[model samples]
Target: MTAITINFNNVLKLSDDQFYQLCRDNPDVKFERNAFGELIIMSPTGGETGKCNASMTADFIIWNRQTKLGEVFDSSTCFKLPNGSDRSPDVSWIKLERWNALTSKQREKFPPIAPDFVLELMSPSDSLSETQAKMQEYMNAGVKLGWLIDRKTRRVEIYRQGQQKEVLESPTSLSGKDILPGFVLDLLFV
Candidate 1:
């Protein structure tokens, strides 16, 4: 169930509008774009992964609701990154001020900014190397904090801006640290 990647570096490159239209026309296939304009097609995750994704998304949503700090986005929300890639993290959040900077139309379409925080949960179909690369891309695109959670391994890779990635094994919880003050992720279920 590994995701397929189509290299478009030599092929005809899709324009931003064309890519948007392609996504809109094909609602069933999940697609992503790399900085090199390569197309990534991913299949739907299995039930276990779906449940885990939902629970983690709910955690971020609840925190955002309580703090009113920023906008929270689920996996379906794609972002046009500064590097020209289109990515969708499992759970993402942006600072209120930064989000406010975008106009209504910008908000209506795929957001044109990287999130302040991003989270990715590994599914059975996902490859660890590919996921790690994606997390690195997030950091390079201005994500302040990112987490790569592998439920099967019960481990988490913490990625922070201008810092080395830290791997934690079998942790029961994760702190938001300075990036997400007063927030913590209970990973008991994950």
Candidate 2:
């Protein structure tokens, strides 16, 4: 199923702590909040999608381990963006310096910083328009690099700060470029 969005800005507004508590209270539910304070209830991915996500996350983890230049996070980690939105990408990374800058509490809770790189792997239930909008939000919130990968279509859209997004069709791989030197994503396995 696609995500369900609830607009409660008129009747009630949830503070950051309230949102966190809501998530904590509902451990089975995956949640996100838009900049406008709307709540998005996300469904769990199917087996194939979950497998793809795991593989991609593992790739990031391995790369980060070798480089030691950043920390890699899986889909479960929600981040509080500068635009007041709480988002969780399929995979994300933060520069070592930027991650070290966070207070212990901030790191313990929803991180209050944008990731240096973000990746969104579209599941069957995901809406392309909504995912694209989310990617734009990440870029606006200072994400240096982002990727929107559509496994079904075998297409990828690359987002970079201060540059228009580049779309690749059935590419064999993706380069991290200057943002993640020596990092290349092998789309063949994905």
Report the number of the highest-lDDT candidate: 2
Clashing pairs in 1: none
Tens digit of lDDT per residue, candidate 1, span 1-190?
A: 8999999678789998899989999999999999999999988999999999999889888988999999899999999999999999999999999999999999988889999999999999999999999999999999999999999999999999999999999999999988888889999958
Taking the tens digit of each residue's C-alpha lDDT, what string does model 2 give over 135-162? 9999999999999999999999999999
Clashes of each: 0, 0
TM-score of each: 0.97, 0.99
> Among all windows of ten consecutive residues in candidate 1, which has the lowest summed lDDT?
8-17
Q: Which regions of candidate 1 are displaced past 4 Å?
A: none
**Native-vs-model 1 lDDT?**
0.93
Q: What local lDDT does model 1 show for residue 23? A: 96
